[model samples]
Target: MKRRFFCSTLFFITPLLILACNGPSDPGSNFSSGSVTPPLFAHSVKSLLTLSVIEPADPKRATALGQYLVWLVQIDRNGEPFPVNAISIDGGMPAHGHGLPTQPRVTAQVSEGRYRVEGLKFTMPGRWILNFTVSSKLGNDRFSLEIDVGH
Candidate 1:
């Protein structure tokens, strides 16, 4: 009976010890608690769609180097969740004239206007612009989110 109890205790404590030693699986999860700059407002005159980051609030400073999920929602001029037929996300450094290290793709439409983008990895620290093209029955609109990394 004692041997069985000891084995169970050891098994549970071993995993805890390993986790504590390694720390957070993704260190980038500790970035400053705030939304991206410019407040994620819409700029298009005709479409008037806005994109706001809902996860990793401060994308300017990532918590890890691997792929990360980017969550965003779109709103219309009336401040209501606006549904779009499709959305494409891409980014790059304007100065360097290059694109993002990873090709982020829209994985899902969480709701009417919310979206989840996966496979976004910033290999290096520099200025990055995330361009999003929103399309719907009405028309297609484009907007950009500017992120400054390693500053």
Candidate 2:
């Protein structure tokens, strides 16, 4: 009788001890690296303006660590290409609580409504939000492009 009671207690307590040591499992706690789903690189800052990313492509290709990348900016109004007075670009990962690793500048206007972005670099694979401030005679509007940099 004593031996049977001890075996049953050991079986129950053994499983409980194993579970306690491992802790609870969270389904959403998985850390995904690289291969992030691409986001639509377009947004309407306001009725007067729309912004889009034209370079590096959506679902940005696998960029090696510490490599320089170029971003292209395009603007439109009423379905037609329109140029803004000045465009400023900046980016960061809100989830990571950090900003970009480099300061990207709109070096030149490529055409009527397109601009060339230079000095862009991604240090890691994650989601980054690119902020574009479009200033023109009408006013100023801000837009964002969510980019996924792969490893």
By lDDT, the best candidate is: 2
Q: TM-score for all predictions?
A: 0.63, 0.67
Candidate 1 — which residues are off by over 4 angstroms? 1-42, 45-47, 60-67
Kindly provide the TM-score of model 2 when superposed on the true structure, using C-alpha atoms: 0.67
lDDT of 1 by residue, 33-101 (tens): 564544444455364666666665654433244446465555454677778888787978888999887
| Clash count, one per candidate | 2, 0
Q: Candidate 2: misplaced stretches above 4 Å?
A: 1-40, 62-65
Backbone clashes counted, model 2: 0
Estimate the lDDT of model 2: 0.75
TM-score of model 1 relative to the true fold? 0.63
